[model samples]
Target chain A: MKKHLTIALDAMGGDQAPAVVVHGAHLARERYPDVHFVFFGRSDDVQPLLDAAPLLKKVSRFVHTDDVVQAEDKPGKALRRSRQSSMALAIESVKAGECDVAVSAGNTGALMALAKFILRTLPSIDRPALASLLPTYKGECVMLDLGANVECDASNLVEFSVMGAAFARTVLGLQRPRVGLLNIGVEELKGNEEVKEAAEILRTSDLPMEFCGFIEGNMIGAGETDVVVTDGFTGNVALKAVEGTAQLIGRLVGDAFRSSWRARLGYLLARRGMNGLRDHLDPNHHNGAVMLGLNGLVVKSHGGATVEGYATAIGVAIDMAHHNLIHLITKDLGGVAMDRQESEPLTLETDKQAESKSA
Target chain B: MKKHLTIALDAMGGDQAPAVVVHGAHLARERYPDVHFVFFGRSDDVQPLLDAAPLLKKVSRFVHTDDVVQAEDKPGKALRRSRQSSMALAIESVKAGECDVAVSAGNTGALMALAKFILRTLPSIDRPALASLLPTYKGECVMLDLGANVECDASNLVEFSVMGAAFARTVLGLQRPRVGLLNIGVEELKGNEEVKEAAEILRTSDLPMEFCGFIEGNMIGAGETDVVVTDGFTGNVALKAVEGTAQLIGRLVGDAFRSSWRARLGYLLARRGMNGLRDHLDPNHHNGAVMLGLNGLVVKSHGGATVEGYATAIGVAIDMAHHNLIHLITKDLGGVAMDRQESEPLTLETDKQAESKSA
Candidate 1:
């Protein structure tokens, strides 16, 4: 481990940027005493906020930048204007070895684009997938390719299985995570060509994980496996739908408790236990989504996540960096056949193609 | 309307057949006094059960069929052996105009194949989509192609929108339903080629419903639209994922209430409200899935549905028949651009083609 582990922050990103970014850093500092931050944003806006936290200001370095990537900016537009932007500079720090990892709560598409364009993916990596932790019946399970690639081939899915297992190991602290590829049915005859092909490869692969075969959508939140893998489109829809279902349940539960006087009184008495239920359903409980397959760790927090949520994102970056999640993935991926396409040298042609595809 | 509304029952289908079928028929009889049942099964097995319900016996007719379609029968094998199977005979009754609709709690794939083969799709309809009502915040919303087609083209999605709108209008009683095509993002630029093309057509098509553009998976249960449409692959995954989420919430709620004595006491006091919440989230609340775009009505009840739930499936069939859902779909489809492909000549070639696709 380095004497000082640095986490680069896009201070001006997020819905409540500068403020949440500073406060979240302060909270993360309490958790990791040896951690340092390099804040990349307009100095005038960030300097005053850092002043409020003497401890954080003591270990943090400030770099001024005038460019800001708007939340509505598309990936292609954001990449062209990336040179002076806080998000780009923060990621640049990682590529330049100035920081161990980069953390941002910026436009997800832009963050993904800039990270891929600047740092590039690891060797043999075609695309970096978005990985996040979702609540399940047993506890929490990791799901990957959560909108990174709209469509994925069999090789992409196989790569996802390896990456997802590494994530579960480092983030969730499991030695050999049980991995599953999401499909409509568990039978061999079910699902599309890609899913069936992926299953066949995973069944034979000798990766450092237990391949539990196919998992259906309903079985996702049931905690049937440690890691659920799928194409970006299906994964993204299922994740958001799960979130929506949780919210719907919360709303209905509230309505039920307030339906009558006895129910209202009963709610007051059971407020503690009810609060427990709320905590379980809350998305903020485990807040960070890592862009796996990248050469350097890059974590994306929810744009509208709270102070604690942003801090939790920083925690993920720290854990991955400390535990060497990148090294683990590199070793696991060595055995698998991953296509080579994009490169580190910044070329407009390649980046533009990736930006459009990632868009 | 016919003086007597006849509903065909695959008296040997479902987890609890004959008994549940007869009892469910009795339940529907109470709701609609003009309804009659044509039960197709082994008379030896079903007649004794029917005799227990004298009122149901008074208005029902029995057709002996020793052969039965096992729950695990594949559609292709079942189609070849369907001549004497109870499910096939029940659907044949609909095609022969002996019954207004067919209701079964049997294997969904076999039911869909046999129905499509026997009755065929309406003119200009490429395939019949499986449509069902899902609970939402506002009330109930209809979602279509819930695993009927593994893949769909642009025109198929448009036809689903038309069929889904008709369903919402008849089943949910919405005068002019608001429709939304399921996509990862609400943006026009987002989603696959087929989804975008469907949106363009629906945007300008003078369909008898409101087109609300793209709807993400999260907004499905939020009741943002009365009808949501998607390809079968995505639709089936989302539906089951939603089911998993609901079950997770139910289990968590139970655990929370049992956490403490106060919570348990509170739950007792709020029992009525809790029960209401349970009923709202229960799949049985909206029991039937209709094979829309077909010339005849076919309702699929959950395999494990109770007597009440089976009756609810019958209720959906009765509503569609009373409202002339088929006639409405035929008229609405006349204006839309739909491709015609499959036919009802009972040829081995055509039925085999659809059987493989539907499988």
Candidate 2:
């Protein structure tokens, strides 16, 4: 493995910004000591925390920026006032190749917006997508277009399949990931025209992935495919619903154990095993959601992520950098344009980072 | 409470067919003594089962129909071969008012098509939606457009909200159920044009429901609202994904208990409380999915549902009939058309029963 990877940090972002950023970086450093971080935030706000953790300061560089992107800012507004902001500067460093990757605990739309404008998408990619790792019964699967582009055409779906497959190869270390389109049904003739057309194109294309025809939402957690491809609208809803179900189950489990004294005694005896189950369901275990298909790697950590969760997000950035994610994406997109050229040329208007980000 | 109610059953429908149908009806009868059943299936297939359960046969009438609707048949194909089919006859009885409501453990698309053809929709409803009860943390909530319409407009969404609200009122016994428009984000200006426009219309229109502005997929299981309204495509994916998550958590919990002897012992101790949790997660508890906006009530049960599951489905139909679902839906949709006229005339072409059922 290549050593000495420097990650650009959007220190003044997220719900608990500078402290979580610095603390998360320190925790990640313990796991991968050779890694370096360049923090972009107001020095006064970030430096005091970094100073408290002496070892983290030794290998890190802090670049002061007075402006922090507000969580509520629309993508267009965030970009219009983007220059010299911590998020902008952090992304710029990666554009300049000063950092191998960028990690941010920030608003998703703002991060996607900045990442798209600063780094741009790969040559073959029509629209870059947001991808995340979800824990399945067997292991993990990569699901894409979480919320970046709500409306996608056949070309966009096809592109997502390619990007998703490549990310699975890089992060999950799968050689030929099984890529399936997310649809209402697995029937050959199911879904809208775009989904069917995309499946048809994928069926014939020589993409560097196993093209599973169609997989339903229930199959996502059953480990039916290594990578799931879909429009952001369906993908986003499915993901959040899965999360909601997890929460519902967790609460139910807790309530069940606490309902009576006998159950409480059993819970005590099964505490070790139950803890393992909790570990499986923790958001920290699956913290990072990568904005794929960009020229540079950009990983978005949850805004409410704790030190451990943010550190896991950093680990994702490190993995992407170590595994040559950009090159992998480029390689996957290589054969896509050749097989299918008859579809309508893609439009850029529908692929906004956020709903009100038209400007 | 009104006790005497007649329900039409497509006895030859579902994977377990006449056996599950007969058993489920008997189970429901034990709970509800004054109920009557009209069995629409081959008497030879259903007769033996009814003979085994004498009390069921006492309150039921059998109408022989040799033809059975296959699960794989497209909606249009099913309709083309509709005459004397068990599903068709069962729905036709509802149309003819021989039964208070129709319950079928058949394919959804086929049931929706036959229901729409024979019963027709109410004057105010442009398209009927597939609605189901989902198990949330606190209790249950109604979710609509499970897979009836792939593409929905503002008018259709507003219609769904109205229908879903009425159904919640009928089944859940809430006078004015809190209705939420399912979207990717809960922000004011998130999701697509249809969702935004629907929110605007519902905000001003005198719909007979509490218009909770927007709810995310994650909040569905958290009991954010009593009714969730969305396009069929997203609703289908979200519901199935939630089911998948439940399966995953169940498997994980099972594995955790089996990992060691101590856990196995603990499992024995916690068996009672754990069983309650299992009941909460059981598919049988949330079995029925109603096809709303029709002139008469139509309830679709899971094809693979066991006796208890189909009983729950029957229970849903009983509730609908008892509370006058059609009247409630008509009242809920009463003031919607007057306030919104700017949207393009509702298109019947986009609202398909199934993907390949455009015919």
Candidate 3:
């Protein structure tokens, strides 16, 4: 018999909490019958919601906490004051081995801060990166460092490439994912110092991955590479830009269809096609953004996500837990780090020297 | 009668070359009866195309130049060796006051490098930024520093905001355009030192524009502001991402419509609406990217743009020339720079001191 995958939930987090969290868990429970949930929030608020879903109630246990982290609470303030908060407690549950993975639809900064503080990073990882799967023309691709660290060095970027590739491999089921560094231009001489340095290291390093030197922003949606690595700032902006553009086009198409009776009739005939298009691009289908490099798994659902979206986030957590994603990432990272140490010790030393000099 | 606006064209540049250039000139001439053109390329290559368009030939003069700058030519190499090249001669015409503006569909880097070297920057401007129009939900908006300078300081961003606002006011016909600094987050403390410093400056400055504190990438397409100011690196990436997303959605929508007979029938009936959308989001409709801050007006058309796209680029040059865009930018910059100098001389001194100390 297989062991049930356990997931801790931050029930009081997102805009529409406890209710969506409970309902989402019920939906996920239907899909993964062998999954159990540990809900963290005020039991009074969560108990009533769970009472409606008997299946979810049967497999879920509530951990009562009166304190709740506000959406606007700064990362530092939350880390210091929100020890008993639902978000923090959920992450702590993962740290305590009570759950295999933690899922939160909370303030991103607060969640990331608490997860990092509680779980810490993998031994070879310097900083944890936020990674998500984005639908591309070719297929779905994984992009990393999505607003985790505002600024990242060459080493941080290299680490993100490894993590993102590992993610694409495990989540998307690619055998050997192609990784590319995001830059303004594809030329070797383009971009800032850090990107150039990262490319140089990736090109010469003994990392067991296909490193496609550099890719521009336009090529990202073209699925030119399976894994796209960038600093948190660029990654966040690029992701948002892609989302915005997709939404804008959707709106424009709707407006056009509504313009005339003929068009509206055409829309009726093409409703199925439109639904297919909508479903393909829907955020609910691509809900969870995993905080990679963390010792324990932490999946962050979009703050404004729906019940289905939350359920999808739970599904991602389940899949990752079942597959032992953290173990795979650690093994791959160790291999790459060891190879770099053996082959390019001088580069690593230079990086350390640069960091110390800056410090 | 209004005086005619003379535009110098790099007839040998772009993929389609003299054919598209000459045909585009004909289209522009039809739209603006008072416009004149100077074609710069090998006469044998350009003359035949011009002869076919008798109306364009009537208002155009041909300047023969056999030296063509290849698309792969490096910027530095182009600037040094391509003196008699069509692109160079066309810009020279603008510099010599023979043409009000110079339009090229040549290499972007080559055009920017040469334009900077020949036209030079305005006295108050430190760098020339590339600005372009983008379709937004609200209407149309302008974004600047597309790919001109890869790295920018606080002052460079401030200059871009000022220049971008001027472009919006003069070209887009906005009375007082709202200007925003692009960042990963909208919070005051978010982003790097340069962005934070620029925000601080813009917030307190006496620049005659409504300074929206910060805008995220998602809000750009929502048309949150009339002018979006960012560094060339971020700007270029964001622009490409937007384009990529649009194309990806287009492809997805196409695939969806083709999936079933019902969708095909619907598409046939809704063809008009789709056409409306196609025209709205078409890159051809938004063809020109102006190299702002240059002493002489230099418009860069997309290398692979269609005849209509090239004609639209010509229209942008005509609009800028008619509105005296550079003169307006210069005046506004002078006002802001003077106010800044009067109010924050210490800030300027501190910047210089920091630079020297770092040096």
Candidate 4:
């Protein structure tokens, strides 16, 4: 028999929380029969929802908590005051080894703050980054630092690149993922100081990954690389821009089809093809945004996600646990750390020499 | 008789130059009979192309220049060395008042650098911004600082807002345009110090425009505001991301319709509706990216634009000249400068009081 993996869920989070959370767990349970769940929310509110899902009820345990984190609560305030909230408790369960991974459809800032405060960062990791799989023309690619560290230095960007590579390898099952740094232009001297410095490091570093120079925002959709690394500010804006454009196109297409009877007839005949396109581009298929560089696994679902989207987030968490994502990241980051240490002294010497020459 | 506007064209610019430039000019001449053209390039290469279009040849004159700026030429290098090149001469014509505006499908960096060098910036404008019209749900909106300045301060952002509003009013014919700062979040406390500072100023200042606080990247396509303001780095990335997403969707839709015979039949029946969508979303329909805040109007066409796209770019330049865009920007910027001076003393006093308190 396969060993069962436990997932801790924030039952009282998201727009429609307890119902979608419970139903999503049942869907996940059906897909992965050896998975169990630990629900963190008020017992009275969650019990009725769980009762409807018999399979989930059989393999679930509950840690009742009356407290909840409001979506608009500040991250600092939530970290200090909402310790017993469902989102916080779910994170705590992962830290305590009661659950293999934690999944939450809650306030992103609050979840990140609580996860960082409770679970801590992995060794040699300065900051944790948010990563998600984005659909591209060639295939799916991983993009990192979605909104975690908004203003990142060269070191933070390098760390994100490493984390994103590990994610692409573990989740996407790629033997050697080609990573690229996201910049305004592909030229070496195109961006600001931090991005240029990061690109230089990635180009020269002796890491166990394929570094494909630099990629522009348009290249992200073209699937030019398996892993795209960027500072949180640009990454977050770029991700949303892509989503917005896709939605705008979909709306325009619908309006066009509805404008004429001939088009409506065409829609009926092409329903299967259109369905395939819709399924491929659906947000539900790519729901979870994983927080990397953490000691334990944490997946954040969109607060406005539907039942199917929430279930997909749960599925992402399961896959991470099944593949031992944390272990893969640690191993790759360990190599990065060693490489940095060996090169640091040489880099310092070079900098000092250049400064002396300029002086 | 209506006043005629003469446009200087860089005949040796873009991928398919000389031919496309002459053809595009002819198309523009057909649309606006009052517009004349002065083409700058080698006469040997340009005369044959001009001969093919009798109407254009009758209304156009050529300035012979053997030198041309390569696509890969460095902006600074081109500015210093390529003074006699076709692009430089076209810009010089605008500066000399020989032409109302200059249109180029050449290098963007080269054009910007030369335009800034020769024509100079408006009196109250510290940096010239790149503004382009983007299609939105409501109709169309203007976004600025596309790639002119990668790093911008609060003052620069405020200037972009004013410039963008003026562009919309002059070109899109909006009575009172709503301007918004593009940010990671709509909350007052989100984003970096520069953005926060800009928001505070826009919120408080009286600049003869509607300030809609902060709008996210997704709001760009939602038609949330008439002007979307952001730093050049973010603005450029967001614009390209939108274009890339549109292209990706177009590809996916084509693939979907070709998947089965039914879909193909549907495609034939729905061809008219699909054509409408294609026309609306075509880059050729919106081909002009104007360099705003310059003393003279300068329009940058896509480097790889076809004849129709090039013609559309010429149309944009003509509209800007006809509406007196520079005069509108000067008037708006004059108001902004007055507001700044009125608030400077009070801001200085507040800063001193805060410093004294800290001491």
Candidate 5:
């Protein structure tokens, strides 16, 4: 039998820590018995709950760490000072080859810092990017650098496209994923100088992904592109805006349903469909945020994630490990580099002509 | 009755031209008998709509212009070549003192270019900003540079804050409108170089608005800020993301209601509250995109706006004119230059303490 992927998790992180993280671990263990978890943090904080579970004992290990990086800490100073932080140690375990993957719901900046410092970045990658899969009408769209690198140059976006496409293929199971640069408009010269320069590089890059040109925020959720790339600042804003609006509208709908007995009946009747949609659109279900272009697998959960969110994150880590995503990314990008060196100037003109007319 | 603010309308512009514009003019005129519109286009194109409606004849005046700017045309070339374009003539009407304001539901770039060329920017304003009122938990929030200047520096954002504040105070009736720089975090030193520099400048800018420090996208709809200023690229992405999420959630709820009989009953029972919410969240109710920092008043309607959306935009323009928004912006910013010469070093220690505590 194939061995389950071993993942080191920071159990002391997030708003709903210990309880939610413990619940998540139980759910994941039940679903994937082959998976093993090493819960890192203060054992005193978790012993009572850990002592209560029998099945959890068979699937889990624990690493005691006493420190944590606070959310409000200065990124540079906190990352430097928190040598014994559970988040940092969890990632280090992956780097030390003790685990296949690491998961954290701690401070995002600290996670990114620790991942970058310990796991290191892949070749041809200036800075590793964070990518998330968002549900859309057609299917899920992958948007990268969702708040990793603040200022990205042309080369940075090209790297994001390649990494994002590699992710879509390995995790999302897409073939030749179409990549797009996020801009204010779809027009070629519609954005700032950064975008204009990036478009030129992406158009000519020998990356395995199909560079689908520029896309707008409205188009991102509409599933116009399989992989969308943008600098971290803009991506973060866009991601948060979508999240905020969804929560607002969800609240509005919930309030409407509870307004009267008739509406409650309507909600009851629609419970099945609502459940299907709830399963589909729930961020908790798609909790894992992959730190792409990194040497090892790392997932960051939301700071306020509940138990279900952590379990979903573990599931994502297991999936990535099963598919050997890191090896696949290396192979894909390596092949692209090899092809670029051997081949003559390819028929980009044909591609451009085809791009001018599309579905 | 107070006469409606006379706004010159570029009738030949937009996707559903002549029809939407004419229908909007009639609707506004009927609803608010004081409102008046001056339509500029090939008189023949607009005359047909007016020929059918006696009420439109009462609300609108026609000006003949032979040229029109297509959405596809390059903005710079379009503005330079289409000297006799209806959109240009409409703005010129405002500059020529023939109208109180100019309204267009045209190619955004072309409209911006024409407004800048014809109306010119107000003194002390580097670039005019497109400030749109977004519905939030706390009534409405002013989001500026929603796609005006793509590239902006520190000084540009300070100017945006001044102009946006004036609009919020005069148009939205916000008192001491709290202006926040849109950044990734609330920290004193966070975000990109542009945002950091802008935050510093805002600290000392002698604008009439209250500088409330940094605000992130999630905090926007939470009523933490009254006016949020960012570079155009970020603002545009945020706005589109919010709009897209609302649409997606709307689709999900509609699907739920149609999925089962009980859900249908629930929807019917909740119809009143749901309707209220749908109306509250509708983008049309917040249709005005005021071009702040311009010497003359200019408002833009969405290119694909319905007649109702156009009417709301007209109402917004009327309100701005009535509040003397243009004169207020000029006075506030103009006074800054004069105040610097007149006053001694304004010790803002108490203000800084308040800001630090708030941060």
Candidate 6:
């Protein structure tokens, strides 16, 4: 048998789970002939779809788990209680070295909790962060801690900055990714104390990276920064805003296309151009959010993701596995074992130093 | 000699200060003939521009202050040191009741600090927030805490919610605005403990408003909610993301419109339609960030704002002054003077409760 990239996919997560998840796995199986998928969930729920797909029947395996972690359940509580959930099983596959990567479209909070609880953070890593690839007008930018650790301090932000840069290098094909500290203003002293403190440490820290000072929100999609580091709270909010704005634009185009026959004809005339634009704006095309700094590779898909979205997510998992991104992040960011103090803890005095100089 | 809407303009503020600020003031005077502006800066700087426009000389007054605050100056220090800065003088005009509104595109932090120190928050309001009317595909949404009070707790968010809703109702013509908590997920448990806790308070608080529970980033421009409340950090990030994405889309469209002869021909054919869309997406038209929960009306404009943007900001200030938003916030939400005990500080237990009930 040829060596295959085995991926354990949690099939019972996400808003359209089992159906879209199973379909996505099948679609991915066709695209990547060498990928072997282990679908974890209730066998009864997944069997009908697997039986329907000849390709899935050929290359996929089933790891039965009875519990389904509802999106509504508290993340910590759900992770602890739903021990047999598909998400937990999928992560376990990576922990047990049964699969090269784990993919899920389940409750993101639960996935974060379970993955952190089971696989744990890499040594020296303070916390695991979710890094999402944003398709900007210039090209693509990596936005990290999309919705992971919300209440992060200066040190957590610094760690995130290093980890985000590493991910950008490994996945986004940037050699020395220009890391930007996302703030309201582009000036050096523009953000809250946490951001200000982080900026100071990032400036002087002898990390093998490029620190591109501060970047504001408007520059996020301008392709000014390759890796934008922010706490999960702000990052998640910004990601949603971009997503919301894109969808809003889509709706506006739709409305304009339907207003009048001239408009409709105009819409038909512009359909090709609009489609080209849609090709870039579509969320499904940019499907995966990688949980970085984790010991095991875990990729989360949008909970409302369709089959195509899942396929895109699976592709992300394959890329991460192929490049061994987690291993690289571990090696590059001090093996994730360094204590908080060792990982360049920024002090108020250093921040004051930058402030004084800038002033 | 007709009574005019008097605005104190900070001529020495912003990147293109003295030039763009002077030009913006001239345009506002030309556009709004009954509008009178008091230019705050050196008389020498104003006289040269005033010489060019005889109409500006007729409609404007000058406050000669030599000091100017640089964008990089620390807010607290700048607020103290730049006592005679143009922006400070403009703010003082409003405090002295010499002008209906104070408008500046200068150092935002400094402006905010000065406004708070001089004018203060409304009775019972803990912190003042910057709120703006954001252009959406549907129409517009009111977003609060755009760049004020970055480090906030749940009580601050609740106040933002109240203030944002009132602004939306007063400015955007929304009745009983549906207040949405901007968070990582629609599920209540999906954000930080602060968000979760805020969700619970918003649910039970007697704000005489329509509470739409939780909303994520992408929902803002989708008209999912009329008023979206978040902390300064997240709000600023989200607002900037929208601004950046819009610029990106504009650039892409501009490129496509100029790509080739055939595409250029297509662009010509769709010029009218494209123009309408472009006008709809223009950020300048969405001018002004209202500093909500303040004791007086304070508006912040883009430091790089053109004449039209400043004019629109002045118009918004007129509307704010006309409606007495400050008084409404104080009367309805018990602005900054409330006892700390009654402020209802957020706790982990409330976060857990909100998560279990709604998530």
C-alpha TM-scores of all predictions: 0.93, 0.94, 0.94, 0.93, 0.90, 0.85
> iRMS for model 2?
2.2
Range of the 10 consecutive residues with the lowest summed lDDT in candidate 2 chain A: A344-353
lDDT of 3 at A11: 98
DockQ (Cα-based) for each candidate: 0.56, 0.65, 0.58, 0.43, 0.32, 0.35
Lowest summed lDDT window (length 10), candidate 3 chain B:
B335-344
Off by over 4 Å in 1: A337-359, B337-359
Residue A278's C-alpha lDDT in candidate 2?
90
Which is the winner by DockQ between candidate 4 and candidate 6? 4
Flag regions of model 3 displaced more than 4 Å. Answer: A337-359, B337-359
RMSD to the hidden true structure, all candidates: 4.4, 3.0, 3.7, 5.8, 8.2, 6.8
TM-score for chain A, candidates 1 onward in order = 0.93, 0.93, 0.92, 0.92, 0.87, 0.90
lDDT of 2 by residue, A1-359 (tens): 44689999999988998889999999999999999999999988998998899999999999998988889889999889976789999999999988999999887898999999999988777789999999998788999999898788888899889888888888888889999998889988788878988898888888778999999999999999999998998889899999999999999898888888888888888889999989988888888999988899999999999999999999999988998888877776667644445443335334443345344
lDDT of 6 at A276: 70
Q: Give me the displacement of residue A119 in model 4, in angstroms.
A: 1.7
For model 2, what is the C-alpha lDDT against the true structure? 0.89
lDDT, candidates in the order shown: 0.88, 0.89, 0.88, 0.87, 0.81, 0.80
After superposing candidate 6 on the true structure, give the runs of residues whose Cα lies further than 4 Å from its correct spot.
A15-19, A42-56, A64-67, A70-77, A204-208, A335-359, B1-5, B11-36, B41-81, B120-123, B173-175, B196-205, B335-359
Candidate 4 colliding pairs:
none
Interface RMSD, all candidates in order, equals 2.5, 2.2, 2.7, 5.5, 7.1, 6.3
True contacts kept of 3: 0.81
lDDT of 1 by residue, B1-359 (tens): 57878999999899999788888999999999989999999989999998888998999999999999888888898899877799999999999999999999988889999999999989767778998989998888999888888767777899999999999999899888999999889999888767887898788778799999999989988999999999888888889999999999899999989999999999998888999999998888889999999989999999998988899999999999989999999888776643333222323454565577357
Question: Ten consecutive residues with minimal summed lDDT in candidate 1 chain B?
Answer: B338-347
Q: What share of the true interface contacts does candidate 6 keep?
A: 0.58
Best by DockQ: 2
* Residue B318 lDDT (model 2): 93
Clashes of each: 0, 0, 0, 0, 5, 19
